[model samples]
Target: MPAITAENQLALPRIERPGPESRPRPAWLVTTARTQLEGEGFQVRRPFPGLEVGIADPFLLLDHIGAVEYAPGEAKGAPWHPHRGFETVTYMIDGALEHHDSTGGGGYIADGATQWMTAGAGILHDEVPPAWLVQKGGLFHGVQLWVNLPASMKWSPPRYQDIGARAVTLLASFDGGALVRLIAGELGGHRGPGVTFTPITLAHVTLAPGTRLETPWRRDFNALVYALNGRGRAGEERRPFGEGQLVVFGNGDHLVVEADELQDARSPNLDVLVLGGRPIREPVVFHGPFVMNSREEIVQAIRDYHAGRMGHIPPTRMDFSHLVGEHIDQDRGGTRR
Candidate 1:
């Protein structure tokens, strides 16, 4: 569920309606997410860099974190980990996650806040729920997206963008049936606050039940619609989809999704994350936390990380010892000890 909402969406600026000539992007592929344990054993639904689609170009992985509730002392999170050659965008929708960046970018991204970290050359960090959430227990629902960087800028420098919920740009569809939370990129002449090395558009869209939403999309960028919750139909053909389903759209300047006339009690509306970037189109060699252009570059990244070149773990952060002796095949997407 989206943590931010407007009492009156009508009062918000409306996204201009796509003209009749605007080509509607048709749903090319639709796939469901696979549940898997990540980090320190928290369950996540990963939809891409996946079997259905090896990669989403410029975007690597999409992890849909829990809409699940946790009991006291049952909460878990990722311990100290290293990442390189990309950016990590974590958006907290309901609960909070405290981030400890070795680069002094630590903060609490709770209730619709975003932690955008650019692991340019490399960086080490840990993400965990706050002490209160861990000890008291409560609801936790969020998303962590991995955006790939072009080879030219992969080693630029480690940077962080702490986008508070208040900083998010809220927009309404042309007919006012949807609320679009612009996390990054531009839409209908409006721009979000996120800065990116790659050209992309990222927005959390909430479609009111029984309503239809159609908006103009950048023809240059790829289009993706990920159902975070609720039921919906996508494309001109009205292909039915539900929560955890990822819809990839084909070439067009317009995008569309229609919320079901009735939705589940828990999700009264269709909420989908709409994101797509200009394809990097370069060779991708992924191994563990490292994404590089070649297997040699991936190996170099691992060696650098082990040699303390990425960043140092702070004394206060907890170490889970998760990375030792794990060797993953760069192209096979498999891990071998």
Candidate 2:
């Protein structure tokens, strides 16, 4: 991956609403995330699979991985695992992670990179710290999202989109006081690089104090904002939010976000993730990494994994792009090629 240089910024046209839009006053839906030990002892804040289960339908879980510093050789990443019926999106803000999967696909996504893995049918994979990072330990921070696939598409062929930092669309703020990196869905009429089985809006936003953002969205999509750092106010009421807090919003045609404070040295910045998608409203039965609509399908997934139906990747280093279908070009700018 290349360094995310200033050259990656684009002065593209902003997304416009065709007509009058309703800006719903966002009422707070108190949601809490429970910390769990995941991937070889790393602490993760998980919102769903708990009281928040099925809150973000078509989106099963959101795992906010560490923003914690790790000493050399102290990082322990997830080993081999099997997933079926959904996609796993890993968005890295700091450090490096190497990934290998059962489909013979493998690669590494370092700082500012993202890996979108569609585990349709079934797939085995591993996400771990790269050898170099383990040798010279540094800060490791990122988020992983579990996106559920509709039952009809659960058995579709698996795929991947390894999006580099420079490849992500960075829509500058109207006044250049903030920026939004769209990972999936459309923002400001500019689409993200990720090709999705379901419609979704995922973005990483950085804001300077007093920066305000308003973007049109699908009225039916469920919206939420997770503060990665600093504090800010959002919506018509200007409800305040802080780091690590998740804010669920009422239905609306647009999202309103504003930054009100500077990030201190103890915090990173006013970085927040805006995620929303039309609810699938399907039966969700989860067993470990497998998410399916029925117990029968879950059984089949386990059998498929144990029977070696989902391919395998060797324990050593390898690149298996040959198994990936049509290539996705990495355009370095506001829109992906």
Which candidate tops TM-score? 1
Candidate 2: tens digits of C-alpha lDDT, residues 229-306: 788888879888877777888876777778886657765457888888878888987767777898887788768866
Error of 2 at 83 (Å): 0.9
TM-score of each: 0.94, 0.87
Summarize candidate 1's per-residue lDDT along 65-114 as a digit string, tens digits: 88989999878887677788999999999999988777878799998899
Give the runs in model 1 whose Cα sits over 4 Å from its true position: 51-55, 318-337
CA RMSD, predictions in order: 2.6, 7.7
Which ranges in model 2 have alpha carbons more than 4 Å from their true place?
1-21, 51-53, 315-337
Error of 2 at 30 (Å): 4.0
